[model samples]
Structure formats: C-alpha cells, structure tokens
Target: YINDVCRTLREEMKRAGIHAEVHAWQKHLASISRKLEYVPRQSNENPLSQLHDLVSFRILVDTDNECYLALGHIHALWRPKDGRIKDFIATPKLNGYQSLHTTVFCLHDCLAEIQIRTHDMQRTATYGIASFWYLKDRMGKEGSPNSWKLSYKEMVTWIEQLRQWQQELPESADEFVEAFKGDVFQDQIFVFTPKGEVKDLPRGSTPLDMAYRIHTDLGDHCAGARIITNMDESGCLVTRQVPLDYELKGGEIVALLTNPAVHPTRDWLHFARTNAARNKIRRYLKTYERESQQADASAPVPGCQTTTMTIHAQDRPGLFRDLTAIFADGGINIGSVSSTVQERSRAIISLSFHLPPSLKETLRALLHQIQALHEIEHVALEPHDDTF
Candidate 1:
C-alpha cells in the first residue's frame, strides 16, 4: 500500500507539474506482550482491514499555493471521504503545524490519509517533549530516558534538520556524509520580536533578513529597524534605530519599521543574507519593472503627443472642409494640415494633432470615424515617431 501510494502520488504530481517527492509510510504491526492482554497485533487475521489511516503520505512543496495544487490533483484522482478533510494551513495548530490533510477512499476500497505542506512550515522547530514525540513518531526510535543530558532544544533542532536533510537527498551518496555539506543548523541564532516571540535565523543575519522572514510585504516596505536596549524600571522598552544592514545579535528584541516610500533596490541584494529574502526582493522588482513598462506603453509620449493622420481621397471641392469638420465635432484641435494634389483628381492630405489625456485611448475610434466619411479611399494613422 505504501509503495502504491507513493507511485500514484508521484505520477499525479508529475502530471500536475508539481515538483515534490511524496513520502509514504505504513503502520508496522508487530505483536508484543507485557502480559498478553491480547493486542490487535496478536491476531494473525490482518486487523488493518478494519482500520482507516493505515497508510499515510506526506508531500512538501515549495510554496503554499503549490500545496493546494497538489491537493487538487489528489482529490481529482480519488474520492475523498466526507467530513475527513482538515485545512490546518488556514488555521494552523497550536504547535504551528500548517498543512492540508484529507482521507481518501483509494486502492481497491482501502483508506489512505494524505498531508500536503510547504517546505517553509518546518522552519518553526519543535523542542523538548514535543520534539521527542515527533522523532519517535517519524523514525520509530525512542530516545534514551536521560536525553535531556544534552540541551533539549539543540538536540531536537539537529534531529529535525537531519530528518529534513535525509528526506531531501537522493537514494545513493558516494561521498562521506560529513563531507557532503557542513552543519547548516549550527550557526543559527535566535532573536526575539517586540512581543517576545522567538525568530530563528542564521548567524550574522540582518534585521532586513528578519523582516523578510516575517512577511514579504513587511520586507518590501521596510525602511529600517529598531533594536531593543535594556528596559527601564517601569518595564517600558528602550530601543535604538538601526540600519537594514545592522547585524542582529542573539536574544535581542527587534522591532521592524516600515515606510511606504521605501522599496527594494539592487543594493538590498548585497546585505540580504538569506536566499529567501533575496528571491522575494528579486521577484517584486521584476514584477514592478514589467508593470512600469506596460504603463509607459499605454501613456502618451512625453513633451510631444503628436499624432499624424494621412488621407488619400477624391479631390472634391468640399473634401477639405468636411475633413476639418470631423476634428471640430470631436472636440479635437488640429495643429497643422498639409495637402498635395496627385494624379487623376486624387488628393493626399496630411494632418497633425495634439492629443489630450482623456482622448488618448480614442485614437482607434477616431480613425474609424474618418474612414466612414464619403469619398474616403484610404486613411491611416502613422506609427508614433519622436524623431519626426
């Protein structure tokens, strides 16, 4: 069942273009006796037939959006059981577990549970007894009774990091594990938010990095930060303003400051420590640049919003007067008009006009209006050229 679930999940993810590995596990049933009270494992009749959630699968994608994408694919493949779906991402657990969970009827009427979460959710590491319970649940190994001999926080941090690392690696590694990558979790420092909530970050991480880690919108609008100094006898916080590049020390309470005028520039890439921060800033800048270009394309050219219209029509006596009246009726002001009589009673007339802001978008309709006039053979609005 575990293997089949993994294969099916991977196939669906691949079809949906979601690049994430599915981790699956089955409850290993083994009979053990304290005094033979008759556990379910004691029976050889296969008790799993009566149980749901015997097989479970976990999928970790890059972003919260991808989590839902993968969830949609899973439900489309199998019918989910009613009242069995839980959305912890929208309302996270007390332990801050953010994932979408559902039980589905699958694989020949068997029931399987699926959990979909993003990779970022695991950054909030569990500590103490909670960590021990998690390790036991995932690895099936109970720690020594005196596991507190080492700092519980440090021990569990390493365990969680190691678990995530191991899950991410391929099946084979020719090189020694120590030589593969150095201890990434070792150089981390824990800082505090103004409200005393802890924020774990890498060593030498700046306040700007913390801003981004907290929320992308905060990072985008971040001007600088205020580092907490010692509190007064009244217990009020005393803080000193700091630059974005100021390195945050462990145990310091930092309050991020924002200004609407502030925006991420290329210089942010220089001091931004985390890859997540850098990536978000880059993404925002890219989107901003694209939108600016689109706006510029639609706007009139600065200083000279000159529009030229060329008309080739029959050289009737009232032709010039009728053409002038079109602009007057539409509340347009013609800057200049030039005409030349060509062969066989054909008149080539060119007119230049300055467009107002409100009528900028009506150029197409104006051209259609000119085309509807009598004796109009051909008419065209020339491409905008500032060099003219």
Candidate 2:
C-alpha cells in the first residue's frame, strides 16, 4: 500500500511538471543497505499514506533564488488554493531547515504536498546526522570529524545569517517553518520578506518569530513589530505595538524593534513557540544577566538611567565620520556607536551617550543639523530611564 501510494504521488508530481525522486521501504527488512541508498533511511510511510490530508512534499533546488522559481512553477501548474502557497527559503525553520512548500489538489482527487529547497538544504534535511560522515567519505583523509565539525559550524553560521535576514524582512520564523512542515513537512507556512527573502515557519506563527529570525538581539530587545504587505500601496501597514502573538500571513513584512532595558519574559517563551525564538530569548536573558552581574561588580551604584540617540542615514562616503564629528564638536562624550548597511545603500547608526542636562540643547541642535543633510531621513531619541 505504501509503495503504491508513493508511486501515485510521484506520478502526480510529474504530471504537474514537478520532478521528484520517490523511494519506498518495507517494514523490518533485513540488511537493506541497497534500499537505504534510494530511501532517506527515515520512514516516510505515514506521509505517503496521508497524502495531502496529513502530509506534504518538498523539492530541493540549487540556489536561494531557484527556491522561489520552484514555488512559482508549483503555483502555476496547480492553481494554489487561497493562502495555501508558502515561501520559506527566505525564512528557515527553527531547526535551521529552509524550503518552499505548498499543498494542492492534484489530478484524481489526490492532495499533494510539495517542498522546494536548495541542494544544500536537501542534504541537511535528509542526512541530518550523516552529513558530516558523507563529507568525510567524499574527502577521504582530509574529511576528518574535525573537518566535518568545522563545516557544520559554518553551515550553522550561514543558517543563522539567513534566519536573521528572514526576521528583519517578513514572515515569522514559525510561519515559515510551519508552512514547510504543514503543507510540505508538517503543515507549515512560508512567508517572504519585503526584499523577496523567504522564511519557513510553522502554521499559526506570530510576528515575534519574525523578530527572532532576524537576530537574537532583535528578538531579546523586541518591543513591538509592524506588519507591511505588498498589497498596501500606500505603505500604511505600520500598525504599531502589534501583539507578538498575532497570526501572520505570507507576503507580509514585519519590522521589529528592540528596547535595551527590556529583558525576555517567561511568557515570551510560551508565546514564541519556536526553537529559534525560544533559544534566542534565553540567550538574551543569559547575556543580560551576565552583563548585569558584571556591572554590579564594577559599579558603586546600580540601575542608573541613561539616554541614547539612534540615527538613520543613507550610505555615503563620509556619513559616519561626519556624524561623529557632530558629536565631537558638541563636546559630547561618545558612549558607543554601531552601524549596519542594508542592501549596500542604506545605513542605520546607533549612538549611546551620558545625558547631561546642559548638553540637551547641543544634542538637539546637532541632531537637527544632521537631519538637514540630504542623506539623513530621521533621528530617534531613546531615553534609557532604567540605566543611570
């Protein structure tokens, strides 16, 4: 029965213009090493039987861009039910899986689940444990466990970067994974960032997952998020103070904010519901706790309030130096500065400083002057009332 089901699904995928490799396994087979080469070595028997009702399918591609192209192909071949198509290559699963997935009714009342992933992602999913072993075998003596470990670490880092990009762009992490899991893996959702990034999240994921996918720091310091959609031509999707638990949709972008003093709450762990988000929240809390302890050890008094200013500007040759000069000319002691360029053109600068009542006017004037520059868009003043 399972073999027949797998064959039928494979034929259907082919009829729909999707190329898929299918493998079948018998229960309790003896020394089935030959079968192992074709099969994933993991039992997919149930998914085969469940078809579209209980299980889905995923396709692995070669590049991040190809993932979306595959999604377009799937949707084009089979009319996607409203809200059934998802793109998660931009946003990955909590376990660091990335793919594009969808559920569609194929010919002859067969519901099919399709998953699309990059080649690298496909290997990661199928051989989660044996990836390193395979690498070692391929490289012979050079492919030692240590080499595999290094490769694994590099893969993890790449996934982390992708997760961060997904969070910053759109589609909560859970939604991205959910789309992949549900329709493809376990009934998941795939969302895209504003810049066409894909995220695979679980079904019913919230914006908080999006925040964490961007960075642990963003997730830990996350104060709120705004949802923007491609349909919103006026760009009025900036609904502020959005509830973290609000259900997210595909093609919507979420902008996340972080508050320096805000620590991750226990409720966040419950609400987040994704390994990536939960782990990030915990990491933030741990880091914050350690920093608090160190500060307590060094400080004469604790919990002093501080004030900071963040500036956003276009990337120009002298933008950083010019901004720093403004502060220097004002005789303001610079506490710290951090900046990141997005898409290689736009830049965001964050500066922290000790607030002196007398320097308030100087700071205001300096900010005003900076704002007057053609490259500068807006400046935000953040008061660190808890840290004096």
Candidate 3:
C-alpha cells in the first residue's frame, strides 16, 4: 500500500510541477542474524502512535495570492472527496500552522491524503516547537519574553477547557475525542473587511463572525448584517451570497455595521461555531452585562454637535491620515467627516470636530498645511450649527 501510494504521489507531484523524493526503510531478521554473533531485530509496535497513511506535499509559491491559485489548480486537477478539502491558511491550525489539504482517490480506488503549504509555512510547522531557537539562530538576537506569553495563555485556556469538559461529561470521552479532532482541526473561511483586509475565519462563519473579525468591540456591538453584494431575482448571488457558516471560499469581501444597544445571546453561542467568534461574543456579553449592572448604562442619549471646514486638494495617499493626525495632535476630537471627490481630480474634505477655543488659528494653520501640499485649488470655512 505504501509503495503504491508513494508512486501515485510522485506522479502527482510531477504533474503539479513540484520537485520531491521519497525514501522507504526495511530490515530483514535473517540478514541481521547472519551479520553478527549477537544480532537483535527490534520492531517498535505502538498502536496509538502508529503512523497513518497521510502524505504531505509541499508546494512553493511566490505570494499568498498565488497559494490560493495553486489550491485551485490542484483541486481542479483532482476530484476531492466530499468534505475532504481543508484550508488552514484561512483559519490556521491551533499552533498557528497554515496549509491546504485534500483527500483524493488515486490509482485503482486507493485513497491518498495530500498536504499543501508554502515553504515558509513548512518551516513554521517543523520548527515552531523550538521557535525561539530558530529565531535566535536567524537573527542573532533574542526577542522579548512577552513574545511567548500569548502562546502560553492560549495553551492554559485549552487545558482549562479540556478539564472542564472532562468533569462535565466524564462518560463521553470517546465522543469528545472524536468531536475534538473534527473541531480543533478544520478548514477556514476567508472574509474581507470593508477596506479589504482579509480575515480568515473558521468554516460556517456568519456576518456576525465577520463583525468580530474586525474587532471585538465591533463584533459585540453588531446590531445587524448587510451583505454588500448585489442579488439576482432569486436573491442568490449570480456570484452567490458569501456563505455564512460553511467553509468560506477565497476572495469574498464582507462588511459589518454595529450599534451599541446590541448584545449577544446564548443562541449566538450555539450558532457561532468558531472558537474565536464564540469567545468574542461571550466576552462582549459579559463585559456589557457587568457595565449594565454597575450603572445606568443606558445608551448615550442621542445628541449632536457640528462644525465645518473646507478642504482643497487633489486626493492623495495619506491625505486623510495627515489631516486626522493634525486634529488628533491638537486634541480636537472629530464628530464626523465627509468628503466629495470631483471629476477634475480635486476633493473637498469637510470635518466636524469639537470646536476649540482657538478655532480660527487652528483652522488657519490646517488650511495653510493643505495649501502647502501644492494640490489645493482653494480653501474655505463655513459656519455650521449643532444639528444632525
């Protein structure tokens, strides 16, 4: 079985343009006895530690995007068995290992497991146990102790959860083991932020999972979800509504809106299949629950304040960052900001920040900086009232 499997794998590797070599070891008891006066033939047999018929294939790629492209090529070439595609790059393994895996039938009804990962991912997987040792060897320096603290914390949490599960359901150890294997190692979904940051989530993630992916605060405060893509007459995406919960495919973008009044429910925990999403919801609920218990904790009564400034510049990178940095440096908090991009390659940024006592001078200096950028056609300030 091993020889046949190895031969099929080698063929596949060549077809996929990967370079690899396989080696097998064997020993004969008769040969060993004849070679020496005292010959010992030892065979280590441990059923629990027995090696499985898993074949790991490493593929090198130029970039993260190329990694997904390789996955597509491999899947298209092989018929993956149902529920056999696992993408850890999107969700990653518990120890922060990332890869793409699939099981397929190769040569005469024989099933083979294939693991795909980039060169860097392979190094991380092999040396992650002695991560600090590798890092010191590479950089000739030691990193801060705090670098490993998060890993330690995650380990402790896993241990505590395991103990709790054992205590709560002592008779279901086998069931727990099976479920743990299924849950702890699984494929990931790739979702996007409104600004296009990729978020790798566990399979079966919802828009709520997306919200938490942005930030815990955003997730807890998520009131509702809005799928940003257009729908057809049947309401299914000509491109599909990025599936919520099931394994998320690569190249899906999502956005989330939040309201402070929203709170998570126990049902959310049930529906939230990912540990990250569930833990975030629980944390948010606990925090808000405590806040509610301590004080009035009512949503801040809606109120409004307003100011207006005219921005004159060609839209450029870091323009918003630069403008906001000025206000932030001056300790002027923004109430709102809006901008209009014109066809003539000009833009007007209108900002509504807390009115400072020295408003005129601040406005003048900001306008001067904007004008100094050499892109401003003109600048103006308008009087505005505190009404939303």
Candidate 4:
C-alpha cells in the first residue's frame, strides 16, 4: 500500500505541475502498542473497523496555497470516506497544528488517512514551533517572510485568550466551552475567483464583501456578482448576475462586475457583510457627501484668484512628487495643499492653487495633465456633487 500510494502521489503531482523534487511524501503504519492502547479506550463495537488512521499518509509542500492544490489533486484521485474531510489549515487548532485531513478508500477498498500540510506545518506537527524556530535559525532564514512567526503570534494570542478566560473565571466548564466556541472558533467558507484563486471568508460573507476583498476599486464600483458557469469555445464566460447581498456557499466561482458610473450608496450598508467592506463604502460616501460639514472648509480664498481641487489617487511613495512636478511644469503655484488618507489606502489631496487668467482659460488642459500622471484616479474641482 505504501508503494502504491507513493507512486500514485508522484503521478498526480506531475499532472498538477508540481515537480518531483520540491515536495515531501511520507507514509507510516501506527505502532501496534499504540493502536492497541487507542482502541480499548474508544470502546468501539468493532475496534478493527473503527481504526481508520492505522495506515497514515502525508504530503508536505511549501506554501499554504500548495497545500490546497495537493488537497484538490488527492480528492480528484480517490473517493473520500463520508464526513472525513477536515480543514485545519483555515482554523488552526489551539496547539497551532494546521493540515487538510481526509480518509480515502485506497487499494482493495481499504481506508487510509491522508494529511496534507506545508513543510513548515509538518515541522511544527512533528517537533512543535520551537524546533521549527531553531531549524530556521540554523538556515539563517529567521527574518525572511517569517511565516512561522505568524504561527508564533497565534500561539501567543491563544495563550493570552486562555489567561483572559482564567481571569474572567467562567462559572462552569460548559460556559467556558461555549465562550471558546463563540470567540476562538469561527465558521469560514472558501470560495474561488474566476481565475481559480481561493479566498477564505467568514460564513455569511456576501459578494460585496468578496469584491472588496479583491480590491477597493472593485468594491467602490461594484455593480453585482457574475457567477461564472463555464467558458464557451470563444472563451467568453457564461455567468449569471447575482445581487451583491447574495450569501456565498463555499466553492462557488465568482466574478464581480463593475460599472464606472456605479458608486456606493447608503443602501450598501444593509448588504455589506464584512467590516472592511462596510468601512470602505462609508469612507467613499463621505468623501463626496454633499452635506459634509467640511464641504466648504476650503471656501474660496478672499482677494485671491484660487481654485480648490481635490485629487483622488492610490497611496504610494513619490506620488506627491509626480503631482507637484506636473503643477510645476504648468508654472502654477499651489497656494495650499492638504491630504486625507483613507483606511483603504486611498489618498485624497485637496490643493488650493492660484488660478491665473492663463491657467484658468487652460484649467481643463492642466487638470488633464495632472490626471495623466500615474496613480492618479480622479481630479475634480472641490464643492462639486459627484459620485464615485
């Protein structure tokens, strides 16, 4: 069975475009004493049949994404036993173990347990996080990417939660367990983009939430979801438009549609399912809000030919340099410049500039030049009513 599983895994890896040398494959049989000791305690009607993990197989890869790819390949190859699939990667155990586990019917219709995890996860599972940290130190990769550091942080968070629970002192064990279920444990679903990349979202996440997860612009201009069905011979997708409020069931392939004319409305608050999404919508709405108290904060300067303009752009280094360079080329002096950066990494720059008679006549042309600068999204004269 070991030989058969190994050969099959190699073949599947090849089919999945995973080269031979990078991944690790291992198999083991439970020791007799351990199996004997485990069975009697469970008191199964038939101990022999109850032990599904007697023969265990492991496929260790490099990254969390590859773990899911391996899982897809394995499930495609074999029929998994009913109710045997467990996704520990999305929700790591209190001990920081992460894996994708499933029991499959292998050769001769015999049951075998398969565990898929990243190599780092396999190390943590085998020798705990300290050993992983030590191995990383030996390799001089302690600070590179530092994926294990995230696990360490999660461990610390769990310890802190435990301490908080102790201080709070739950009235009973049942209450403590309930608190754990409500706080520490969360229900999440995995969905795929039209391009097949998986995204883990909370159980009740809507398509609007998913759109925001993909990008702030995608969410800001989101029209609705286009549920991808399949591609035709011409390579165009056949998709059904779903409402932004539509709740997701795991495994749905979704494509968010956008309209440049569409923008967030107060109605969106009722549909948004994630705090990130809801907050982005609120920020966008407030930016163009007509009733905003600060709407006239940049009221026309007295005795000066000035124009108040607000430029919306993506936040990045050297962006101000490019913007200022454009105005300098136009030979215009900025009377005043202030910026408000939003939580979603968007920058709104309000610039008050002396509108010379020549510049005023060619204001549209000058604004066009500023708009052409990379990273700049919209350049609108302030105190104007405009949607996103």
Candidate 5:
C-alpha cells in the first residue's frame, strides 16, 4: 500500500511540475519502539497502526523556496487529513533539522506520511553534523578544501545554541523533553509579509508576534494585520484584518498595518508567543505608564485644574471645525490645540482645555461626546489638580 501511494504521489508531483527525488520506507522495529516511548499512555492504540511516519515517503528538492512551492502542488493533488500536516521547514528542529511533512489518506485507506526537504537537509537528517566528516574521512582532505566540512561545523555551532536554550529554560529533563517535542519537533506555521519574506512562528502565534519579530518599533505601532487567505467559496483570495487574538496558520500572507496612535494593549501579553515579543510589549507598557504618571504630576498649575485630551481619528476636512464647535457649545475654553495628520488617512489631535471649578463634573461627559463622534477611533483624557 505504501509503495502504491508513493508511486501515485510521484506521478502527481510530475504532473504538477515539481522536480524531486522521492524515497519510501517502512520503519524498523527498534526505531518504532523508541517512538512509542514518546506516545502518551492515554492513547490505547497500537503504536504500529497509529504511527503516521511508520510507512513514509521522503522527497528531496533543491531549495527552501521550492519546498513551499511543492507543498502547494501536493495539497492541490491530495486531500490532506485533518490536522495531519506539519511544516518543520519554516521552524527547524532544535537539532537544526528542517522538513515539510504531511500525512494523507491515500489509496486503499492507507495513511502515508510524506516528508519533503532539500538535499542538504536530507544529509543533515541522516548523519547530522557528522555528515560533513564522513566525506573528509573518506577523501583524506586536510587542507580545508571540503565545503561540506565548513557547513557541518556551522551546523554544530547552531546545535550548541540549542543547548543554551535548554539550559536557560526552567524544566526538568522529562518536561524539557516534552517542550522540545512540542516547540521544536512539532508542526510549525509559516506566515509571509507583504514583501513575501517568510516568518516561522509557533502554531498559535498572533500577528502581534510577527510585528515584534520584524522590529520593536513596528510592533509598538502595530494596529492590526491584513491577512490574505482563501476564504471565498469560489477559491478566490480574500483580504481582511485579523483580530489580535486570531491564531495564524501556515501559508497565510500577512501585511501589517501600523498606526502611530495605536499602542500595544494589555491583552496582547496573553497572545504573544515569542519571548522577544512579550518583552517588547511589557517594556512599551511600562514606559507609557511611567510617562503618563509623570505628565499627570507636572502638567497642572497651582489653583487651577487642567486636563489633556488626545484623540485619534480618521482625517477629514471639517474634523477640527466639528471638534471646536463641540467645545464652543459646551462652554469650554481650549487653552491650546495641536494636531498632526499621519499616514493611512489618520490624524492625532491633542487638546488642553482649562477646567473651571464649576464645569469640573462635565469634563468626563465632554470627552465621552468626542469618543461617540463619527470617525473617532480613540479618546484619552487625563486630568490633574494644581492644589499641591
């Protein structure tokens, strides 16, 4: 059954114009035993029949880019089993292994696992970093002439980096092993930027994580992600803004839309996957809170109450006219007004209004009115007493 599946898969690849070498194999008993140890005891199933990779086909391609191109073709050819596809090529194993794996129900109800990788990756999977020494040991090259030896040494350095992560993580041996299986060995999702650059994130990462991975500034200003996905019934591509809590998946192209007035929300900490992303968000929040406190302390004068209202909204010709008219109708005197038009047809307006003792209670209602206006996205009011 495995052989027939491989043959059909190779034929499909040929039809789809994917050039690669495909090798099929059945797992040895010893290898199967080692794998069974990792399986949860709760699964009361036979390890042999349940193991998807027991009967597998490995396809070697030429480049990393071609791996994804081939993956699209393969999915178009076969109906993948639910939750059976894994993309290790984007997020390589801690041991520096990379591949694209998928299990599908092929002919005769046989479940076959297919592993796709580059030729270099296949060598790494076989002998790991020692694969380079294999050529040198046979060819007697001592003059640093073998490029494979140099590449293998580089792989060793990366493996050492993985060891550093293991040391830094606070986990027992069993826990660490489980984490390794989950974070490194499990399937990964790959998202693409507007420029087509691939970002390998954990399976449930949000768009905010992608922004932080790109740059701290971009992440700090990230408003949302415009994701292009195949959601239409006619198989057409649709673009929409992904909610901050949305979990991203593989092969989705995301274009980040940034707004200067937008900042990280507290709930983002719950969804950020990477440590860098979480740290960046925390730092931004801390700095913002500190600045707000300082401004509250120093912005007010003696015997007077002052408040600042920062408004973010869509840019319109009569926006200022409408805002000032509201202030005039409310009998509030604006001390000063500053506004800046930004990219993406947005504007940031900051207003300092003097709060007389009589009108102190109406300040909150005035801010609420501004927030309820059309085109307004956000409104923040800060008031301080100068009686100190």
Candidate 6:
C-alpha cells in the first residue's frame, strides 16, 4: 500500500517538474517494542493499531522551499487525514530533525505516512548531526560543487545547544534514562530572546532556565523576567513581569534582568527546573556563603591595628603592578607581601597593611576597588594576627 503511494507521489511530482527522490519503509520491531512501553494495556485492542507510521514514505528535495513545495503538491494529490499534519521543518525536533510529516488515507483506504524534507535535511535525519562528515566524504569522492555541501554552521549551533542540555541532564542511571525519555525525546517548546532569536527548551522551563542557558553569570544575577507581549501602535514594546516560577510558552520573547549587586541564593535552587540553572545557583551560593564565613572569621577584633588582604587571580606579566598602584592611590602603605604563582597561572597574594582607627570605615571602599580590578578572581580582607 505504501509502495503504491510512493509511486503515485513520485509520478505526480515528476508531472509537476519537481525533482525528488521518494523512499518507503516500515517501522522496525525494536522501535515498536520500545513504544509499547508507553501505550496503555488494552484487552481487545491490537498493538499494531496504535502505531501511526507502520509504513512511511519520504520525499527528499534540494532546498527548504522545495520541501514546502513538495508538501503542497502532495496535499493537492491526496486527501490528507484531518489533524494528522505536522510541520517539523518550521519547528525542528529536539535532536534537530527537520521534516514535514502527514498521515493520509491512500490506495484502497489504507493509512500511510509521508515525510517531505530537503536532501541535506534527509542526510541529517538519517545520520543525525554527523551528516556533515557523510556529506563531506561524498563531496570529496564525487568532487561535488560547493552548493552540494551541508552547512556545518547550523550543525555547530545545534551541537552547542545539545551541550547545554547535557549539562542539565540527570546523573544517575535510572534518573538519566527517565530524563532522556522525558526531556530529550519529547516534543519541545520554543521561546525567544530579546533579540528575537528562537531557543528550544523543554516544556515547563522557567525564566531562570533561559537565563542559565544563555550564561551562568546571567542566571546568578537574574532578578526578574520581562515578557514581551507585543508592539504598541506607537511602535514601543509592551512587556510584563513574568514571575520566577512562571512556565514559559512558545513564541514569547523573554528578557532577563540582571542586578550586579545581587548574588544567587540557595532558595533559587528550589524554583530552578533545569540542572544547569540549579547547579549554577548552588555553586554560586556555596562560594558566596564560604566567602561570607571567611570574612566573619577574619573580622577585626578590639586592639587589632593591622589588616591582611588576600588576592587571587590568573598570573600574567605585570599583573600585580596595578595592585601596588591602587594601594598608593588609596594612601595605604603595604608593610609586607606574601605571594605565589602556581604552574597553571594561578596567583595568590597576601598583603599586610597598618590600619589606623580613623581609616577603618574607608577600608571597605578600598577593598571594593581591589575586587573590581581586572584579572583579579577574588579579594578578601582579614585582621592581621601578628601585631605590627
């Protein structure tokens, strides 16, 4: 039945002067078994009846526009099954599969599935993102024109997005398997950045997840979300605050607001859905709390007249030169310097300075200045234990 549909489709496309290669296949038994796990147990129902793509036909073309053109011609020839059409080319799958799928009744009233995609898309569908290598091999062997080459730029972008998804995936075997099925294999929702770039995220992802996907620092400093509703008649954007726990929907443009003075809190972990966002929040909170504890332990006690400032950074030529200059500008004289640069370009420097009672209030501003210096990773101030 599907073979006849494929023949008819090829003949119709040929008549229309649309060049395409059509292929047909049945679903593998292993794939059917894996799908059976999800289907509910029915006493009288045949398991095969539940599968939609028992026999499928694929149409391959040369360009994205040709995919739609093929789809339109296929629809014109066959009466499509109501509500059985899906445009995966416009919105690709989570794994970057791009094809237009439709199930139609054809050839003695048997249902058959048809997929339309470009030649490059067919290669990607067959080989996943590794199709670039396959296409390259073909180009090398056949000396194909540059136009025949599959663009690696889109493949690279998908690889980056997959990497971000992997970071947030579950670690344990059972949890990882479940997350793979639920997150990676399922249909995804699309959201937009402020610049109108589309981002595919798992369903139920929140604003914090979007921020973390963009950058760790952005997630750490995320204060709120601005949901772009639409443009006003005056051409200004109308936006509303989307709460931290709000589930994002498709096509909504989200703008993440960041506050430099704010650091991530442990409470953020509870609301964060993605592993990437939660892990980053926890890491930042751990570092922040540790630094706070260190500061408390190093606070100046009564009768302490000296202070020690610890600086950590990546070592470079003349990196510490600016530190001495900053001290001179602040009118603080360094009494002692203990410093070391590790093999991996990591530097730790401890500087001791005499602190008078009158200058105690001004010390915080000086410490802030040191922290803001380029190449400095961390700055912590403590009372010098040894009396000067």
Residues 1-388, candidate 3: write the lDDT tens digits. Answer: 6576566555665676655443333335554334444334337743322222333345554344555555545544554454456666655556766666665555564455666665555566878846734653555445434424433343344455456434533445665565455445655555546575656555666777666655667766666554443233232332334323433344344656566787687667765665556655665677867887654322222342245677878888888888877777665566667999988778888876546445546655665676676566665666632321
TM-scores vs. true structure, each candidate: 0.38, 0.37, 0.36, 0.47, 0.60, 0.46
Q: Which ten residues in a row have the lowest lDDT in candidate 5?
A: 145-154
The global C-alpha lDDT for each of the candidates, from Candidate 1 onward, is 0.68, 0.61, 0.56, 0.71, 0.72, 0.72
lDDT of 6 by residue, 72-104 (tens): 677556656644666565446667777777776
Worst 10 residues of 4 by lDDT: 20-29
Stretches > 4 Å off in candidate 6: 1-96, 99-118, 126-136, 145-150, 153-187, 229-238, 299-388
The Cα error of candidate 5 at residue 126, in Å, is 1.7
Give a tens-digit lDDT track for model 5, residues 306-386: 778889999988889988888887877777889898999899999987666767656656777788888999987775433
Local lDDT at 319 for model 3: 83
> What clash count does candidate 3 reach?
4
Candidate closer to the true structure by lDDT (higher is better), 2 or 5: 5
Candidate 4 deviant stretches above 4 angstroms: 1-10, 17-57, 62-65, 75-96, 100-114, 141-185, 228-239, 288-388
Deviation in Å, model 2, residue 15 alpha carbon: 19
Candidate 2: deviation at residue 110, Å?
A: 8.1
Q: Scored by Cα lDDT, where does model 2 land? A: 0.61
- lDDT (tens digit, per residue) of candidate 2 on 3-60: 5555665565567555556543333334333335454334746423432434345454
RMSD of each: 23.5, 18.9, 20.4, 17.8, 14.6, 13.7
Best of the candidates, lDDT: 5
- List clashing residue pairs in candidate 3: 204-245, 204-246, 205-245, 237-240
Query: After best superposition, candidate 5 residue 150: deviation in angstroms?
Result: 9.9
Candidate 1 lDDT over 41-97, as tens digits, reads 536565545455557888878766687678768866776664456655543444545
